[model samples]
Target: MPTKKELLTNPIQHIDIKQHNVVPLVDAMANMAYSSRDLNRAAKIYEMMLLDKDCGVILCLAGSLISAGLKQIFVDLIRNNMVDAIVSTGANIVDQDFFEALGFKHWIASEEYKYGAHDADLRDLAIDRIYDTFIDEDELRICDDTTKIIADSLEPRAYSSREFIHAMGAYLVKNGKTPANGGADSIVLAAYEKNVPIFCPAFSDCSAGFGLVAHQHHRSAAGKPMVAIDSAKDFYELTKIKLENPVTGLLMVGGGVPKNFAQDIVVAAEVLLGDDADVAMHKYAIQITVADSRDGALSGSTLKEASSWGKVDLAWEQMVYAEATMALPLITGYAFHKEAHAARTGKNFATMLEPVTA
Candidate 1:
């Protein structure tokens, strides 16, 4: 096997949507058929979300997108005020984005090494692979340790994922791990700076879980209280967004916990407000995924189906059957180049959830 240094030489470079104007390209797709037309319409819907001042657009992430070089797109979205709130998997926020904020990088795996052909060797080399992307196992361990450090520094109490994520962003800022400090621009930092709340309902399922496990083990042995994640509080805080800003839109990439968590907030608000359907469903929504709805899995389920459950409105919803990497830049870039988000202002959803002081 080759040396680790040789394998990790080429770091994945994130694509910048702002530099590449795709409005004409995406507009041209409207004349095309199949998924192209569907993607064009989805792009338009995303633009509508940005143009609508009352709409709070929640971007849901449920895949290894950051590691695949989509980090800049998300950071740009947050910076441009295109996205109001974020619902994501812990891996995206912690293992990928936050990990990079600390100066580590995801390398591009060589062709011969991908597709499970060199898995045993990669394991031996302490290199983890996410499809075609490669991450150093040693660096990821440091990421886990960093989470523990953050948790240890906090008061012993249950925190919503949003709150903990905010702490992570604060940690990066305190340590100078932000763009202005000559570090990578990260999703966590952008969200924190913009006061946009980010929720990871299954927060403990990623690197954070390993760190919390180590943290709890040490604190328990010392007979001390430990910090913990309150999944219910995560749900409640997100539901509060729907109640406060009833005109919402969803731009979902792939689907899993983030997609479901974002959609359920509507019903959750209804339950809190009253039984007479006081909460409004997501006004506009778009999901890009390759998963098949015939599998009866939540990831591939149609938004129209979600309306039946009172989650998404069918009139403005569209399901684009395409992969995220191919569609996200074009759709997001279309809106960016059109300057739809330029007219939008950041929605400080994080402050909305903070405890009131007398």
Candidate 2:
């Protein structure tokens, strides 16, 4: 059994799409078969979204993508106007992205410890695992406490996850947790600076939940008003994005709540519009996943199936049946290199959503 320090010495470095030009490689895959061809088309669709001046691109995240070294890909997208708005699982926003914004890191666990052979020993040492990645539990507690601090600073009222996450970005800026301040670049910080809105519909399921629990308890004990999360407001605000930008696209990595939540906004928009709705469905859609639709789960379901619900348009939708980590960098990196001719720029959706600032 190795000491925790020895086990966690190697940190996972995020992949930077800016540093690599993958245009030729992805372009060559145009002639390939199976998932390769699918990925090639998916990348082209994303490029189309970028080139379309009227489209607002929403990036959806699920799984431990940031911890798996995909954080810089998102940061680059946010900074470069490649992505307009974001919908993600709480773990991606709080425990993974925001936690790292505070200058912590996800470490690489050796293969020997990845088989659950040393998990108990890991728990004893206050270490947590996300697949082969390691996060120091002690550092994560600080992330929780920092959320409590942010909660304590806010006016005690129900806030949509977008509003709260905007505050998180503000917190990072005020504390110098940005590349300019020599701390670190992060998805949250970049989105803040770029005025990109990030929504975590299941807002309290991550480290923020523990912090909010502490916040509520302390406030109750002291007989004071407490901050609260409004998931309904999260849905409403995101739906407003759909209403505000009728021409929209989705680039989803993995699936689950974020996938369903982003897709459902189209239906939610139609519900709000009633007679005036143009049967609003996400205009361009791409999903990179390894899930099987046979499971009957939301993640595995096809975009064409979503069209049956009036949530997605079947004409421009593509499902690349591959794992995100392997597929995402190629897709986004391809877009980054081929972005010279794109007419679309940052929508500044956060400013459109509300006046929350960092």
Candidate 3:
């Protein structure tokens, strides 16, 4: 066996290349010898997951990906059928709605601006500029009204997040609301069109909160029992989804509740499949994050920890520590473009790069 000192001093050899552009990055990934072998290896894992017929579900868990300006990636993934289900932060969904509502944009603040004593106030510093461009009153009122509608329509029985979003979308379409602005319109339309399911275990934390409050008001008006969300139902739905899908893949963008929620699905899959599953439960995972693993934050927890629980395949999982805004667009674009190229050329693009299994 190799000594720990040797392993530490000389880690496994990886392809090495230094370039920031997306084309070069994709080319490097395509040619195994062109760049960091670790990255190349990671790309292969992703490709395998995309191609695997058994891999019916792809779960993306992240924080603030919408705020990072990666809604296009989400839209693209849904368009391409890259993801069958999504488990994401409510904040991300809310931010996406905000973006669609007012066509808001995000700008990079200087380090000085971020480090200032009044940094928290900086959010509002742009408010005047925002109001100059768009009004919030209309947006808030629309959100409130939509929440009320969804609350009134929801059945008393437990429903998955995707179901609720779809119901809301149908309602909007019936009411002649274009599914363009930040409403269940986009999500509902995409999922319904794709036949995909989305489960947000922490749905209440997001705009669902507003819907829940509206439900409370509706109940008050009807003099009925106020229905509170049952956490057990969410947990059960997650476990059930994992069991039904033997080959699972996770694409975690950031961390927080979404991160853990995605990870837990893999664990549930392993427990449910046991030894009979051929593809290996949760065989592929990719994460783009900025949190520090050394800090022991849940978002920063490494794939290695998940492997220990058989939640992830140690040989196939990939971790890319970076911003979602920077990574998601590039990867999504590359994957979809590759798929399109394959479709036109009559080639199996999904299997172009094979996983480097141990």
Ranking by lDDT: 1, 2, 3
Model 1 Cα shift for residue 189 (angstroms): 0.5
Q: Write candidate 1's Cα lDDT for 1-358 as tens digits.
A: 8989999999999999989989888999999999999999999999999999999999999989999999999999999999999999999999999999999999999888778999999999999999889999999999999999999998898899899999998999999997787999999999989999999999999999999999999999999999999999999999988888999999999999999999999989988878987788899999999989998999999999999999999888899999898999999999999999987898889988964111
The top-ranked prediction according to TM-score is 1
All-Cα superposition RMSD per candidate: 1.6, 1.3, 12.9
Taken over the whole model, the C-alpha lDDT of each candidate is 0.93, 0.91, 0.55
- Which pairs of residues have clashing backbones in candidate 2? none
* Model 3 lDDT per residue over 1-358, tens place: 3222221231111111111235457656545642234454554565566777666545566665553445555655665667767777654554344324333333333334344544335334322112112113334445656655666665565555555655554554555554454432244455545555555667777666776778887788998765455555555566665666666777777777766776676655555567565435477887777788898887888888777766677767777776665556555555555563232221111122221111
Error of 3 at 91 (Å): 1.8
**Candidate 3 ranges with C-alpha deviation above 4 Å:** 1-23, 29-40, 98-138, 179-185, 226-228, 269-279, 340-358
Per-prediction TM-score to the true structure, in the order listed: 0.98, 0.98, 0.72
Best by lDDT: 1
Q: To one decimal, what is the Cα RMSD in angstroms of model 2 from the true structure?
A: 1.3
True-structure lDDT of candidate 1? 0.93
